[model samples]
Target: MELWMGFYLVSFLNIARCVPESSYTVHLNKLSFEKAQNYCKPGSFLTNIPNEKEMAKILKTIWDENSKTDTSFWIGLKKDKGICVEQHLTLKGFHWTVDNSTQSDFKTWKVEPPVTCAILRCGLLSVEYSHSGAKSNGFMDTTCRNEHAFICKRNIQLECPRPEILSSHDMIEPKNDPYTREIVCRSGARFNLTCSKDLVWTVAGNENVDISQLCLECNKGYRRDASGNCADVDECKESKPCEHECQNTEGSYKCLHSYNGNDINEPPQPPTTTLKNRGNSVQTQPTSPPDDVRTNETVLHIDESAGDISNIVVPAIIALLIFIVLLVIVAAIVKGCLRRRSIKLARRKAEAVALNGSSSMEKVNEKEET
Candidate 1:
């Protein structure tokens, strides 16, 4: 019971005294500085020490298993020949080996690095933990060509598992100050989280948000139905994005086009010109596409069995006949209108002549009577 109480006391004091830093993977392979940086590729890089606090944390992590004696490890620091050194501050001339190029004000050195260019340029963490209760581990400048064990690390402020993200590393925003992140749940809900150089994420507005409402979203070419389960999307019915004809598959739609009433369109393959180098001179040659890129398309072969093509000739004859019939109908209507107009003009002429003759006869009668 007393040991348990003592354990708890030690744990509390340790937690209270040390600010939490993220965990890192230690690589024990003895590699040169350049090779070490190459070994930690893509997702991680050599660890950086921003201050004494981070330096102590790294020491504690490295010497946790064997804190009895002295040891050394490679950190991400190399002297920049162009940078101006400040005598007033710690880590004065050196910067962290990150893209941000940050320098810590809390540099504690074991031995003061020489201002002269004769000494080595790389930074090394040398600890003299001769006994158990040693706290101070200071920096030293050494040659980058020497092989030493190192650790690779990256700070992950937010961790949404693989399936949750629409793509890989979607939630990881390393560029944001204080490492703030906002992730969308599969249910179209959002949660905001942030961390300050630590692994555990502190949920923003934790009291107001409910995590029980997380819903699972379907994969691509799928959507949630009324029952809250994944259903195949009918893209053809919904959007009609295809040009000629659309056939709905299990989770996708296929567009059917035509060459000459065929089912598909074959894309034209272009020849690629490649350069060949020989004896300081270069030659260009045409190359076909790789076998993986070449597609085998099925097309309905055109029939050439018959001499006369009824398919083309019949449609042409029918179109010609229709055009002639339409022309004849139009001509007949025009002739009928012309004939009616002439007849009406003749009737009017006859009426005028008859009236003139009558008038003349009446005038003659009057003269005779007189």
Candidate 2:
């Protein structure tokens, strides 16, 4: 029994590992913060600047150089009122979209927006490039109603972006396997595609040319190295997504936990996320649920959908409240102005009436004297 169990574990380890380096998509299509998050659904979420390295990588390819100037993109950070820490040069009072972790290692602020406005609690990443080709990036507060270009980040493996098919072709879908991210859906102009016993897709007539090679695609969690083999990337040295210690293993790496510093008596930071309402005395619960306990597709989808809805709905409610307040304020101002003008007009009419009456009386008196 032990031998069989050991064999199974080893086989599972042999399966391809995902590179810890996150895959990012910079969406130039402007959207509100909640809308942008919903748009990133199923595969990715809004990016939280995890570390200096990730930020550097993003700046190296931030859309284009010209658009980098005067650019602001919605990130995954938002202020939570539940957190009480209020200090200069900090993002500790906020929560990130992924994992809902409020503890941030990288919190660079250019100018902290005024702490009095609750409407400006959503996180915005202001991006720009200097004349010397240096990039300046910082986090600032903004209303969620504002439309802006945003970023989406996937911290895990990704399915291949569907290859474009220009000619008549057929696609072979994977059967029974859910984890492999190879080119299962491929269409070709000249030949049919088939997956061999070794899981390599081959074109019908061209045995020498692998269709995956033509697509320049590699399996998820791997890239083609110098020898053209799909080798697993050492993300501990490269990406370093772990908080504590990283242990590089056979096909992947593991994050060893450092059980120090945190208070054991403190409640675990999961299942319920606390959010901060800066400058306001209200502590609102954020929409992030406990981490997914299930890895099966159906269960995962249900949990993720619930969390996503929660995330969007709460912010939406807050935005609606803000809109209502603004509408009321404007309505009151217009009403006050109109009331004063009406009173002024009434006073003017009364003066005219009195003056005409006096003039008529004087004319009558002059007639009597004559």
Candidate 3:
């Protein structure tokens, strides 16, 4: 009897364990730097630093929905003020605490970063300890000025009623549609039914539906032909639907029109030119040169003098000008050398005259003294 009681208790615990107790709800919003902390529930905390496991879970949930919104939120971890600390973790996943402050013992630092005064945002995770019931962790500093939605968690325990077995004949078959059928229990029996087919059925006002008919039919842009096959509805076939070109896609069609004032079908073409192969087999004997060709030759002859200046006279004139420039440069160099020599000679003569005058003045002074 004791063994049977233990078995019943074990079964009860197993059933309870299978039921979920907590539900998480995330809030998507835009908040300012300081106001992001306010967006979370008051008792809930933000991250001072984010752990790898927590970060991975948060990223997986956000990316699973393929959201295009760009935002970051605050975490609980923060760099401690005035304390420059570097922490290293051991093999047992325990991190050595560096001295942050003499008084403060709460080691809630933005993870793996030295303590500083830069105010950073943190993410909060709610943890339920076995003995402590519920508590919030400190925040971590993530990238600044990024916006992200925050998740909130609450514990909710569900109590399911005891199940009672009923007789087979106690089931009632509701008479609704002749094609579909439903088996429902009369009050006290366990709410369970087995269907041969895997299709899901929902009860609405005593009607049994296979659920496939309630699906919406294809609209005007989509084609649902006689055999109930869906295809693209070609709008172009219907009375000049597009002003330009039209292309059909699955269930819809697009009209192609040029935005830059161009016709869709008619593109601009290059000017045509006659291809003249110098050694071609076929040749037409010209009766006379065209009037246009003769006019072109006359125009070419009128500019012959200018053409001669550009081809021959211009090159000769450039050579002559180069020779004159060379001569002028040589003359200037010779004149500069001569001017430098004259300046040097004048400086030497001035020095010598001063020295000779000083000597004569000294000799005359000595003679007068004697």
Q: What TM-score, over all chains together, does every model reach?
A: 0.36, 0.39, 0.25
Local accuracy of candidate 3 as per-residue lDDT tens digits, 224-302: 3322234566666864455556666555565564534656544334334445566864544435445553211111112
Candidate 1 wrongly placed segments (more than 4 Å): 1-21, 65-70, 84-86, 100-102, 117-120, 130-134, 157-370
Give all candidates' CA lDDT scores.
0.63, 0.62, 0.42
The stretch of ten residues in a row with the least summed lDDT in candidate 3 is 294-303
Best by lDDT: 1
**Number of backbone collisions per candidate:** 0, 6, 39
How far does residue 195 in candidate 1 sit from its true spot (Å)? 18
**Structural RMSD, model 1:** 21.8
- Report the lDDT tens digits of candidate 1 across residue range 97-185: 86536567556788777675444477777766655544556777777899887766664434433223342223544332333566555
CA lDDT for candidate 1: 0.63
Model 2 lDDT tens row, 193-219: 433322344454444654445435455
